[model samples]
Target chain A: MMIKRLTNKLLMGIIIFHILALSLLPPFTFTEVKAAADSPGFIIQADWVVGKNMTPSIVFTETSGSDKTPMLRVHYEEAVIYGMKLTKQFSTPSGPVSLTLKADGPVRMSGMTVDTSSLSFKGACLRATENIPDAGLEDVTMVVHYMNAGGSNIEQLSLQTVDGNQGPAKPKKTQILVDLALLPYTQALKEVEKISSGKKPLVCDEPVADEGDVKPGEPKASIPDELSREDLVPGEEVIEDRVGKVTDPVTKVIDPATGVIEPVTGITDPITDPVKDIVKPVEKVIKPVTKPVKKVLKPVTKPVKKIVKPVTKPVKEVVKPVEEKLKPVTAPVKHALSESCKRVKDTKGKITKDLGLDLIDQALKEGKTLPELCKGDASLTRALEDFEDGLTDILGLDFIFKALGQDEEAKLKRMKETLKNQKDNFIISL
Target chain B: MEEREQEVQVRSGFSKKAFWTSLASGFLLLGLLLVSFGISGVACAVPIAGVGDFYVKFDQLEGTGYTFYPKLGETSSSDSSPQGTNLIKDVTIKNLQLYKDFKVGGDTIRVLITASKPVRITGLHHDAGLIQANAKFQNLTLKENNSSNWQKQFEQTSSKITLENAKLKTHYLFQETINMAGMKLTVEKIK
Candidate 1:
């Protein structure tokens, strides 16, 4: 009766313990899902690929809009377009002419479009170059199409050979055709294609009815409700199976006598056995030889150590006071030097502030001339002179001037002469 | 009788030639003053404040430009170097007006620049308050600040370089020759 009672108690204890352990374990083990990487801001593809240096002409087609005023707009988000070129080819009276338009620097376009059967660029100066092989025509007329506030319009503009000294005239119009091959193949486009091909599931499609124990006329199980039910119902049998599988391998490898795993023992025994065998024999051979040597050295070293300690203690004691005594003497001198330096720095700041050197600096950065800066302030002039003198001294300008005396004079004279001759080009007025 | 004789000698000492020469000299001095005043007036009349394009090419330009020196008890390795280069630092200015335009060479390019604040070229001596313009550069190369061959590389000629609304500060600028067109310089007192 007592044995039966003890067995029941043990069984109950095991069940209670498992309940507590299961409650303490996490409810769900969620797998982390990584987000997709961001796509590029925009991509440009041209129909006719050429050398990397040469920018191919691009035609943007209107994809979505009303039939009457079809428009395609691209917002660059103030991004600078580097090495942008616009090329137009036409059969002129002379021959087939290719006119390429390029900006002097990177073009910053906020929003633009190559649609409405016209090409219009705003807020940028473009220079045009023509490739005329025969040189048969000094000028050519080309029909240009452009868009404005009033909508797209066509204009005939004349193109003249830019003078060598003058700026190039603006090009008015060029005809452009849509190239279907250059459309960007993005993920959104793929989704659109799937939707158009009747492959994607529609919202109106009915859900598959659940089979088995669900009764008729009762509220159907929604996706979230079903998921919640599955999550709440813990897989006790599966957990127990996994735990059994994990322990089975461990139990097979473990040694009953040592409680060490047999695999670990197998790995370490070969390496440790050879080392132990070699060390035991060497230790036995070295023991007698080392013992006599240790005994002899210990007696000899004791007297020398005793003698050296006494000598070193006295020397250290003597040097300590000297070092202490010198510290006070040297500290005041160091402090005085630092103090003087601080004072000099303070004075320099005061002087710079007093003479409005900072103001002069500000004015100079604002593009003010030195003469204008020092016009009324005599103190400022003196300060500037002093500053210049200091710089001159540091750079050793006196020596440089002495070395390049005549040459320097001649250079200055020539510069003045050149400036005077180009007086119309160099005007300074206020 | 002696006073009357002294008066007579004084009158004779003042001859017609002396009188005419003195009068001519006075008129010449007056003319010189008027001419100088007119020249100065013309200089002040032409204002450099206007929206226009400018271009300059330095075939050969030579100047100390701007120089900066390290302060007392400071090493060159410290932040005292100009434009991150181991060059001297002397003066700092907020605004400087520079204007000029003329062509000495063939095929000139024009630039118009405007800006809110002055565009300062530190290593270069030239200064401008603000610039807003279209600019073009050809065959421009910038040498590294720490390079030992900076001076030699700088001496090599460049085709062109255009900067707009740029605050450029350099150690020094020395060009052998220059060509400029449509340049204007303006200097005004800060209110």
Candidate 2:
């Protein structure tokens, strides 16, 4: 009886442990899988952060076609690329290469590891991955051009990722049904199915037609009469075909025999890849159970059903009180949100009024205004020792959003960024 | 026979009292041990030491680099000379706060400070009359003492702190001061 009690406790502990572990496990597994996107077009971005940096994560997102096509987004706003990504592959075919530098070199590359690249900032200062051209080539140099809020691009230090030549180019393959690094660990059940039941691994073998329906190894029959070398750059390649890898609008015909996209020329039937962006969400649930359900279900569920009957009622009973406790929480949150928004608006009004530019802007929009009024500005400029003396110091913003309460820090930070970057036009308007 | 029976009862009562007292004491001792360790099941990353006399001084030695080597002990190095060459033995540098003054013949020496970490020294004892010292210097700079190297050298020899004519000059007069704190010079002559 003692041994039976011990086993019972152990089983329950394991169930709880598994539930907690499984819940915590998915995000890391998912982000990691997304970070190291296996698709050739998607450059797997791993940020090796040295400090507490709010660095942007490099995500490989399939825009549409059934989660098959991975698009690399590199959106670094305050940067200029010297080696333009002319191709869809984001390659540096040829450019002036100054690879070596001081111990703290601008560019860093490690084979299969991101070390020695200690580029991080207090905020998202490094190259953003949201706007990078989703091309196939492996390496490109990123020269972050610092620009003033006044829209003048200035020469800033350049930073580059290590060359792709250091490691094997990601093997060209069909869309990855499952992330490989998460393999042998996550989705153990799915792997077991492949091994145990001789099931083939999941792959989207859809043929992505490009260049006037040119199949792989098939030359384009009729090139555009006015094709320039610049146009031949991979990026200019048809977004239609590139996007087709995920969803083939033209060739809806899947060669049933090969389970691949058929090389049907000029077929205009469009079809959406059913699995687009849905793999991880669905697989996150399915993969955990895939193994445990088969093994654990037989033994565990028999006991689980027995235990769950008793446990379910208590859980339901416990949930009722939690719901009662949480019901009041919504009222405060709503009240706080309404209060903060009001404060933000009030502060905005104060800033605009203090700037004394409201009347100036209204005049400018009506097509007659201030800078024009300053045609004799030099006459007044002569009276002032310096033109800067005429302008008063900008101040008194700290008290603007005091009522933001909980959101004060974040809102203040956003206001600071807006004033600094003057991007999204909010700062300029202020 | 009745008295003997009473005596037996008294001894049994005393043994029971002793057992309970010892059990309570055991628990109290365990709690104290946990307190000293700073662990109540969960432990802090660094074990904090009680305020003590021990300290690690990297700045006391004249050529030792750093304006303020992190104070590691309750007290700093005193003006007193090392009576013996083995100044340190089996000491763990907790990187605690410390203060010390190093003077040769009432003359102060320049110090190089490193904010990084403290180097651990062990078994620093003078073997014989001669304290042999060997050290490696990186990015070392030498500067002449503005006042006098002779008086400083005199104080060094008198304290049994034997600095060779050249090494003494290297340390005091023509000394190369490392601007870093992490670098440690192992005093082989004294130890």
Candidate 3:
């Protein structure tokens, strides 16, 4: 059949020339992983450290105990440190030395790794206060001064809560975390899980009472004011025991059958050392030893028993003074918030549920006013004239023209009554 | 035979008119042999009388540079001439014609005359100063009292005459004359 129709037109032109050579290739791929951070791993390049408080120093990479805790965040409204001075006078162990550290205000370093394991520090600049109010921001310090090489000691760190959105609907960046081994701090507070798990050392959760109970290493007995007939030291004395290693907590006693520690000397019956393996037993069991109680005499003023025995200190005096009675300042709430103005939109609950009242609409419509629609935010023009007078007392020009015309008023009222009847039949035929 | 066939039929009628008259006499003898060579090329172009006559004959003769200047410019030497040595042998002059004269004081002026070399005069006579000759050769025959005593001694010849095979006949005049008898000059005045 003509060679099978020339092999089916050469297999349909080799399957359309391999689909036009795979549709001219190129699908997706990428590279440039890092480098090009728009340049600047360290560059003060030029600086005078303004009004001179110029403290220049450099050195960081010494961490210990949990690799010396310090995740990144160095926020800066200030910073400044430039240096050079070593023209061959290099002495160290706390003496003369200077070579690099160059910093300038808006510093960086957050969670490190813009290469060379990041957090690199070096002095001055800091600044950032301006519109304050995040509940009046309590702490923001920065200081970092170690001045002459080994003259190490001025690290004031602590300004870290700036993660991501610092608000008015978010976009101004900040991140701040510092700790570089706490060198010169000026305010500090950590425990956001120990500086976000840079690892362990924030401890203190409360555990106090072991000093007076004394059961850790035992030793006590010295009550001999001339033993009365009742001191009973007759031949009826019976004492058989053997245990050791009690370095005096008023004369030892901890022998759970030969696990040894028993120094009992003329005891009055107050022995406790069930082994806590010595070592200053709670500062030697709060010292003051010399005990002797055993009298059964009646009280000098007791007519009868006036017992108040349910005293668990009256339930720890009513649950420990309600835990130091504090927490009460109030008034900073502000929450109804279902969506702040990011770019904008509120419409005050669809104009106060169609005119019942109490509103605040303004998501910028074009009828102007409100200082002509905040013409460049002179601080949002008094919240846009109190949201345009709360949306004109909540929609009343007939519910703002029926919520601005329920679907365009019946085809614009039949095209305005057919152009008003053709202008009244052309003014009654003119 | 009937009189020998009438003499063979009158000699075959004279041999058939003599074979048609010998073929018209062989085309009239080949047209008279082409008119006898075109009459011998017109008789070889005439002239056979003396055929460019060339001759040398001598008789008593004498010659010298002859000059005779008489009038008043008088100094004369008679003979040293050899030009044409006075040639007269059969007197042949093929051409020449000349006439000149100048005798200032006694008035006889007619100067300038010229022609020479192609000539045939035979006889001539001129007066009023020269050239009167008769029976002159170049072919001649003259008489009449020998041309009247050679025209009266050519008017008492007083000097220039050079006529050869001459011709100048103002009616053989006796006055008013200017003649060049084939370059034999003559000029005359008779008042």
Q: DockQ for all models, in order?
A: 0.01, 0.01, 0.00
Q: lDDT at A181 for candidate 2?
A: 27
| Model 2 alpha-carbon drift over 4 Å, by segment | A1-134, A138-430, B1-191
lDDT of each: 0.28, 0.26, 0.26
Q: State model 3's lDDT.
A: 0.26
TM-score of chain A, every prediction, order shown: 0.16, 0.17, 0.17
The DockQ-derived docking category for candidate 3 is: incorrect
lDDT of residue A369 for candidate 3: 37
Residue-level lDDT of model 3, residues B1-191, one tens digit each, is: 99998888876564656765885676467445434533342212111111111111112111111111101000112111101112111122333333333454566644222334332221121111112221111101000111112111100110112222323211111111122232322235433
**What are the per-residue Cα lDDT tens digits for candidate 2 across A1-430?**
9999999999999999999988886566775553333112222222221211111222222221122222111222222222222101112223111111111112111111111111211112122211122212113322111111121111221112222323224333323323432444435435434432432222111222222222222223234425533567665663324322355357676655856676868868777766556445444443443433334434444433333344444333333434333344444332222222233244532333222244233324445322332333443223221211222112112222232355533433323322332223232222
Residues A222-300, candidate 3, lDDT per residue (tens digit)? 2122432345667744232435458766757666685668787894867686767556535445668578777878778
Tens-digit lDDT track of model 1 for A107-200: 4332222222222332111111111111111122211221111011111111111111122233332321222222343543443344335322
Q: Is candidate 1 or candidate 2 better by TM-score?
A: 1
